[model samples]
Target: MTDSVFTRIVRREIPAAIVFEDEQVIAFMDAGQVNPGHVLVATKRQVETVMELAEAEAAHLFAVATRVAKVVQATFQPEGMTLLQTNKPAGWQTVPHVHVHVLPRYANDGAELVWPRKDPPLAELQALAARIVL
Candidate 1:
């Protein structure tokens, strides 16, 4: 894959207000801040989606996101918090990188995650669960 904007940030080709970094991950302030403490935690390897990550990579990705959320929570003191991870374009993934948004939310915040409910019957749900059960 060609280098993503995130890859450029990781390589210092672009500037970012990075909050934390280690060998595998980086946490930085999002340019489009929906809230004051909005942040993005992403993998250093530049994988396009979460499904592509190895088990340990995925684990560390979220671990760092959790740590970033804690700091953002204390610093911003928002009414609520949201950890958003998207997949493909259909899943609202604007950036093609494995990252999670740590957003500090307030009352009446416009950020919305709405999905229609099917409310399938128990038998149908049970059948579906059986098909994908690990």
Candidate 2:
């Protein structure tokens, strides 16, 4: 199997343009950025997907993402911003590591975030929510 580039970054075996770091998470400049201040927030635990994250860990990851997004917004002054999380190949995730992409956007950037929106019936939604709720 191939080595995990993010794991190498975490282990300091490879260099990343790190922006922030704490015990739980790390934020770094995306090597292929959508915009100038684009950043990636990743869990330090080396989980492959969000489903493996504990509730507290997930919360902390998002908190750090939000903080980093705010700085990117302020510093870069993009017209808008996007918080992106992906799962596996079906979800457009290229890397195996669980990471959140903070994409800074601008006017006429030509990026597309199209997805189907299903407006299901209220009862169906409620039933699905019930099934999903823990």
Candidate 3:
């Protein structure tokens, strides 16, 4: 696969306002800022999605994200925050690289995450749950 925009940023081929970094993960300011302190935390390894991550790697990624969220909260003082991690295109993932958005939110920021409620019957939900192999 061709290098993603994030890959370039990781390689220093592109400039980014990075917030934190370690051997396993990197946290940086998001270019398309939903708020003043919106940040993106991603793995240093170029994996396309969360499922591609090993259990340890995925754990470390969120750990760093939690730390970054604290920093954003202290600095930006936003009313609320959203830690968004999307998957494929159908899941609102525009970027293929696995990352989590540490977004600072305020009242009526205009960002909407709307979806229809399914509200399946209890028996139907139980049947769906029974199909899972996990």
Candidate achieving higher lDDT, 2 or 3: 3
Tens digit of per-residue lDDT, candidate 2, span 9-112: 88899899999999999899999987899899998878788999999999999999999999999899999999999998999989888899999998889878
State which candidate, 1 or 2, has the greater lDDT. Answer: 1
RMSD of each: 0.7, 1.6, 0.8
Q: What digit string (tens of lDDT, one per residue) describes model 1 on residues 15-118?
A: 99999999999999999999998999999998889999999999999999999999999998999999999999999999999999999999899999899999
What is the Å distance of residue 37 in model 2 from its true position? Answer: 0.4
Which 10 residues in a row give candidate 1 its minimum summed lDDT? 125-134
The positional error of residue 20 in candidate 3, measured at the CA in angstroms, is 0.3
- Candidate 3, residues 89-131, lDDT tens digits: the string is 9999988899999999999999888999999999999999999
> Lowest lDDT 10-mer window, candidate 3?
1-10
Query: Clashes in candidate 2: how many?
Result: 0
TM-score, candidate 2, is 0.90
TM agreement with the true structure for every prediction: 0.98, 0.90, 0.97
What is each predicted model's overall lDDT from 0 to 1? 0.95, 0.91, 0.94
The total of clashing pairs for model 3 equals: 0
Ranking by lDDT: 1, 3, 2
- Candidate 3 wrongly placed segments (more than 4 Å): none
